[model samples]
Target chain A: MSLTTDDVNKIAYLARLGINAKDTASYTENLSDMLKLVEQMSSIDTDNVTPMAHPLDTIQRLRPDKIIEDNQRDHFQSIAPQTEEGLYLVPKVLD
Target chain B: MTMHTKTLKQLSQGLQTGEYSSQELTLAYLNRIQQYSALNSFISVTEAQAIAAAKQADALLTAGNAPLLTGIPMAHKDIFCTQGVKTSCGSKMLDNFIAPYNATVVDNLNAAGMVSLGKLNMDEFAMGSSNETSFYGTAYNPWADNTVPGGSSGGSAAAVAARLIPAATGTDTGGSIRQPAAFCGITGLKPTYGRVSRYGMIAYASSLDQGGPMTQTAEDAALMLQAMAGFDPKDSTSAQQDVPNYSTNLNNSLQDLKIGLPKEFFDEGLNNDMATAIETAVNEYKQMGAEIIEVSMPHLKLAIPAYYVIAPAECSANLQRMDGVRFGHRCDNPEDLNDLYIRSRGEGFGTEVKRRILVGTYALSAGYYDAHYIKAQKIRRLITEDFTKALESVDVIMGPVTPTPAFGIGEKTADPIEMYLADIYTIAINLAGLPAMSIPAGFIDNKPVGLQIIGNYFAEAKLLNVAHQYQQVTNWHQQTPKGFE
Candidate 1:
């Protein structure tokens, strides 16, 4: 399917990516071309086929709830763009 | 002695025999890295850490016994996190990010006593086919400066090809390792899905990503694999099965080996020169008592489209963690949370990355999810089944690593689809989650071509042996670029 400017804008919003107004036309064209390539999948009939997730067909392994990781909050937060009081600081949303 | 031309075994022997020391080897490599800066192979040359590690390796060497990779100077693809060093993954997003911990693969290599020279450059977030997408800048091929060295493992392959380092680590998701290895005339293996831990290796397409070795020979690749491949509890998807002694089977005979050549791989899409090289390599296998048979992969053509959908869809999800609040790039003075995310991502990600994120978002979005994402997954299963059916009668599958040898740097950048089609032969194997490798087969117009060997799941040892047997009778892997020699 061809992606229009509106479609590109909507998808960029969903992806949380800012497409500069200048680059939107190019983005739309590129995404449309990629979609055209992806459109080849329609040629095959996959009605009975089961969608595969992991290549090995293995289920995600889970471990019991326990704190195996040491608290490195300080070291981790030290690399953040902004952090205060042991939490990442982002622009105010609720306020 | 030309230290850079030495094989892993030769280097190991030199260290043990007291003819050379790891410290000297690392210093030599550091000097060479500087000399070859025009190639843009390295992202960060960890000179101080490398010397310190080499001194430690010398101590180990004096202590009598160390791993095969001990005292060896190598580099990790920037995609792998190295503690206390920048792990950019070739994107502006993580340019300032220093990984707090080493990836499991890095830990594995370190424990093997390998001295890490530094991290090599790669396509941004492992997104592009060529290193041009790298924020660090384009990496040049050692063989021909005008052509790409194949990517996102371009730097790893280029450095090894240029003999800047004896070997390096590379990850493959959709031909990253093999293609570059081919372009740069080296050996690269992508172990079976989950055969190696993904704990520290950055995720691209989770199911398709596998970390292996990029080396000068299959034997070296096998030796490196011995260290890198194993089950890791840290990576849930890491296989629970034991990693075989890959080095042990390097001399195994290929007698009566039932080799399968997929018709799809030999079709018109393949360039004449590459096809001739692959055919000649396959003939060499036949001369070694291997039986060749033609196999059909009816669904092979669909790989590119399916890969485009699934990889991007998964990448969109995987890259979400890169928001401004995290350790990655943050834009200045964001008005609010949404603006912080959009602007940070827009400014941080390159053109190709943004394009993929957008594509992925469209695929996974409402109403179109099944049409694109689910359909791709279904097609993935079909491609895997085709491999299974073909492998039922063959010991291994052989094909060309790329349709053509390395193209000029900006040759295909104008059109993204053209670049995506370059991965047709290699993507099917990743989609099937099988083990594969690309060994230097021959040169086409001075640019190296790779012979791809694929095997069933968990067949890394067998694949390495296959490439090893070929290398035993061939010198393609030993060929270095003119100035490099």
Candidate 2:
């Protein structure tokens, strides 16, 4: 289970991280080394084992849909990198 | 006694009796933090804010309506949101991000009138075993300057050990709190998963991450944990179980207490001196009337691999929200949204964080999901069952916190596998959602070794009891570093 440079690039793209050509070699080496360690799990027989997501075998607790929190849009937007009139401004998507 | 040298219990008593005001105590800690600035323990010191909170605590004391922790100053790991304070999570990405609201842990402690000194440093997004991964430089172990303070809670552990503050809050995903506590010669607890509310505490791995106390003694950790643990409506995963008074059981007799020594923990990987230190502590437990039994955890060897897969996979999902638009670090100039996301994250995150995110993304990618994520989950179940079976036989499991004492800085940074293996003995408890604590047992080559006591799910009181009892018979927890003292 080794990651090629291309695989590292693709994974980086999916993860929304940029990797230049030089760094991709290091990423490939590190990710491949990690994958090698992870591959140790493949030998175990987990045919009957249940996949444990949470530590406790509990389901996610649901809450009433009613509004419990007041609107703090302005307060939140104050910390945004680019905001105007409580609207976060990102690069143009439809352009 | 110097205010910095006093325990949380003593500080509380002093404040209540008017021997010293909260203002005076907060000043003492702030002064110490400044004096010991080279340890790199604190990321941000809230001098003005701490003094203001101290003034409020004094007012509460005057009104005779103060909480147990009123006026006692401490630090929170930067992972917890601190309202107006910078919550960096020891990452460059969040270096400029000021939290809009308090984390539930911070709010709970603040409501108790506990004065926070500031935010302690940690591994970037809590990724590394060594503090070297911190965007801020490594927090040096106060005991040995060249040795690394075990982390991602290294800064918290080092601060507590250095007596910059009596205690500080720390989080553990894979031995972050306990390992650092072990390295720094302090007591740290990792309560059961969901024991403390995670609301506003930056998430690293939702399922395995838990916040706990790092302090001089298990008794202080008990007091801190009592305030920090409970259900919060804000955190959906917060357990609804009734919070127990952890301090009440501290003096409980260990008579006939069953302690399980897992056969796997004492394997060849454990260093000779660490094994000796752990054995010495076990002997002390035996003398105190604990009945020791050998227990076996067959899947214990697989904990590191299982944890790496699961924790990073979860981190990958949790960190996706850190796109430059809403908050956190953004590039100066971006050509487009995709460019914004890529460059901001790539440039903002440290090497270790990026590596984990990459591995996680690869693991969760279309073809590899079953082989990596699902298989890891199943292994996690096996590890949990192994703990369950062992705990059914004994009241607690005792082992060495780390394979050895703190290693020198940069010794293992180049090898990710070596760094990951540093957590082998501690990661299984998180996977099982059990409560565990690390107490300073003794020294190996002038560095402290920790004895880890692991309890059943929600048995934090029992774990604290075991640690507190051990602390009672030994003065290891009281030993401070040379210059810090």
Candidate 3:
């Protein structure tokens, strides 16, 4: 039920976030407290119970394979940090 | 009387009778927003755009073709995207982001002819109970200085309470709408999940997120709901059911109405003053020929834990789009793709946001997936079943909106678990996907408390009727903070 320092690092890395070096100890404590809260669910045994993913319990609605969305690439890219020739510019993925 | 004190219906009639033009009314509210700038209620006031919209509305009025809300001025909770306007979800991450298109709710309000005053302030990513987490600043409660206008819809509630604007739009994933309404002494309704479109509204937790109205009276709330509700194919989760005219049954008699008081809501954690005020309000329901019965929702206490898991999990996935390369805040320089994402998200999100993303990531992480996430989902089913069974016997369930009246700003920030408990009363209804409301019930030590009414799924009209009948006899909702008047 407790999150060690390493756990916080791994979780933050998995979430693609960099934890402030100075705030790591505080993050560890906070996440540990939250886990304590979440751990309360262990009191009840929910074996064989159906997991509810939606409030209404309805299946995802399906539509035919067709493109109904209008292309707004230019408008969308207008707010991007880096875009060139209609492609979003990102750092190199490979050396 | 000055225009700000009038309700939406009153303002609508004024526009129809030519007593006041939309421009005049909009100008009055704009000035009031300026007057109360110390309240930190509004994030952006689109002065030129509001004036232009007012002029067009006046032309419609002159031609005898004005809609119900043609000239009325209100604001959004900043979470809803508005075209060409900044849609900061109270975060530094989206501080520079401008939405290219309007959210469905925004478009709906525009089509209804409601002139938007501007965007309101809120907790970053709708994560916190108090507005202190806002990147801009906290919104002060108009009722009492230093007290929080309970959030994440804190600004909307305070603005309406101060008569700066008649009403505004607010979203509730948990208690974001109802809790603030209770604290600010206004009427707010969170309709059944999917009752309103979420196409342009920023996502918090998709399954639990819903948009509703924050107004002074249930009638005004009904009028706002009429404009904002209905099906939108764009939102896959939007209800396919039709939105009934919410205002049509405002006068429905409460005779023989079966009301249930959930015993769990009145337990030890509730403030004594809150209990006294809620019960006194229930007595008024009895006076109106309604019957009250006690009901128990045993799994009620599980809501907060279940929510911490589900909400953050959903938020983690939803907020993953905030990478440096796209629409939101980006880092200065990136060594590589991983560096861009890490620094951008790290520097972009606030502490509370980072904590949630971390919690959510851990919950959905490889080893802990079934034990944490699945266990929480099964617990969600139990809590939903509790509400379903309780509602089968009662017309509606009544309770206090919060454990106590609004707390002083920065009161519960240090301890996050203590802050999470503020949602104890309001979170379960969302788990059930039922429509619920919070109407001004009474005051405690000069602070306001709201009476919560939870109804069966899609019972917005009945909830409004119940709240409207109470407003008929009591004048609590009519009480305005002294200095503001």
Candidate 4:
């Protein structure tokens, strides 16, 4: 269950985090230790046991379709890092 | 007694009897915060806002319209959103971000006329077992200078223990609230999942994360929980059940109380001194005509493994919203959207947070979802079943809140596995979605030991009653940290 440097890099990339080359060794070591801890779960028998996502085992409670919150887009967008003309601005994804 | 030394209940009485004004009380606490600044307990102090709120509370008191919490001052863990104030969540990611609205708990406490002193420090995004992971810096244990106040609600516990505030709000995902409460020698409750609305609290692990009260006594916790609990339409997961009057049962006799001792909790991991303190607390309960039964949770050993997977998996999803565009920390310059996300998250988050995100992402990654995430979920079901079967014959379960008392600040940080093990005794209850609390039972080697009392779902009142009855005869809860007094 030891994570290689490549695996650490992949995980960081998947998580949308950029790890410097210097930290990769520590990340691999730390993540490998964590995975080793998680490896213990494989020894337990979970045969026929249902996977419990929510503790209560309840589904999301749906509300009637209605407008509950008043429009506060401007107020909400006030904290945005970059915004222009009522839209959030991000680095271009399309050329 | 000065306002800082008084318990929430006493402070409430003082305000009611006109012995002191809320403004005066608020100023006294603010002064204490200044004097105890070395503890690093608070991240933000809203002195002006606190004074203004105190004035409004005073007006309410004069009008005879004050609630029980009126004029009482407290601090909130930075995890809960506070409008117009920085809710840092102890991470640089949100250090400059001001909450646009109040968390439901904050709103409810405010509506009850309680004055908030400010935002307290915590483990970054409530991730670590010790407060050392906070972006603001580690919060020192008020009881001892070099030791850590157990976290991720470390500051909440430290501030209350230091008498800087009578009580503070804390959220427990695994053991954040209770462990810190134990470490700082105070009372903390983590109510059943959905018992308190989680509307604006920053999400870590949505299923296991629950907000509760951290105070000097169970009675104070009861008062705080009364104000904080209730269904909120905004939070769909909030339970629709009626919030019970937790204070009403505090004086109930412990006669015939069937307490179960989980054998696994007393096994190899528990420190010998902690075991003795927990055993002494159990004997006290036995002397009160309570019946103690031994229960087995064989799969308890699997809790740490299961929690690591499930919590991280959920955390990865929840924290996805923290991407640089809408809010939170954004990088200085970005060549592309991918670069923005990668650098913003990498630079903005602390080491622990980044580690968890990486772990979570790997657990939920395309090729590994079933082997890791699904298997962890199945193990979670087994752990929950263990509690269900044990609770069938017992009124509540009792154990050590943590494997040992508070350790040195940097003791477990070097090894993530060791830090993860610190939460072993407290994680299963979260997995079970049950109500549990930690009360100051005794001290070992000058550090505090907490006796963990666990109850069935929606059984907060019962848990409070159990802890309250114990506090009635013991002086442990009354012992304040030295010099801070």
Instruction: Report lDDT per candidate.
Output: 0.92, 0.92, 0.93, 0.94
Tens digit per residue, CA lDDT, model 3, A1-95: 88899989989999999888899999999999998999999989999789999998777788899999899999999999999999999998977
For model 2, the superposed segments whose C-alpha errors exceed 4 Å read: none
Which parts of model 4 are misplaced by more than 4 Å?
none
RMSD for all candidates, in order, please.
0.8, 0.9, 0.8, 0.8
Off by over 4 Å in 1: none
Model 1 chain B scores worst on lDDT over the 10 consecutive residues at: B242-251
Q: What would the per-residue lDDT of candidate 2 be over residues A22-81, giving only the tens digit for each residue? A: 788988898888888888887789999999999988888999889988999998888899
Q: How does the DockQ of candidate 4 come out?
A: 0.89
**Cα deviation of B393, candidate 3, in Å:** 0.4
Looking at candidate 4 chain B, the ten consecutive residues that score lowest on lDDT are B1-10
lDDT of 2 by residue, B143-182 (tens): 9968899899999999999999999999999999999999
For candidate 3, what's the RMSD?
Answer: 0.8
Expressed as tens digits, the lDDT of each residue in B1-485 for candidate 3 is 49888999999999999998999999999999999999999999999999999999999999997899999999999999999999999999999999999999999999999999999999999988888889999999999989999899999999999999999999999999999999999999999998999998999888899999999999999999999999898899988898898998999999999999989999999999889999999999999999999999999998999999999999999999888788899999899999999999999999999999999999999989998999999999999999899899999999999999999988899998899988999998888899999999999999999999999998999999999999999999999998999
Model 1 C-alpha lDDT per residue in residues B1-485, reported as the tens digit of each score: 68999999889999989899999898888999999899999999999999999999999999987877788999999999898899999999999999989999999999999999999999999988788899999899999968898899999999999999999999999999999999999999999999889998888888889998999999898889899989899998989997788888878899999999999898999999888889999999999999999999999999999999999999999999989896989999999999999999999999999998888888998888999999999999999999999999998999999999999999999998999999999999999999999999999999999999999989888998899999989999989899988
TM-score of chain B of each: 0.99, 0.99, 0.99, 0.99
Tens-digit lDDT track of model 4 for B1-485: 56677888998899998999999999999999999999999999999999999999999998995899999999899999999999999999998899999999999999999999999999999999889999999999988869999999999999999999999999999999999999999999999999999999999999999999999999999999999999999897899899989999999999999999999999988899999999999999999999999999999999999999999999999999999999999999899999999999988999899889899999999988998999999999999999999999999999999989999978898898899988988999999899999999999989999999999999999999999999998999999888987
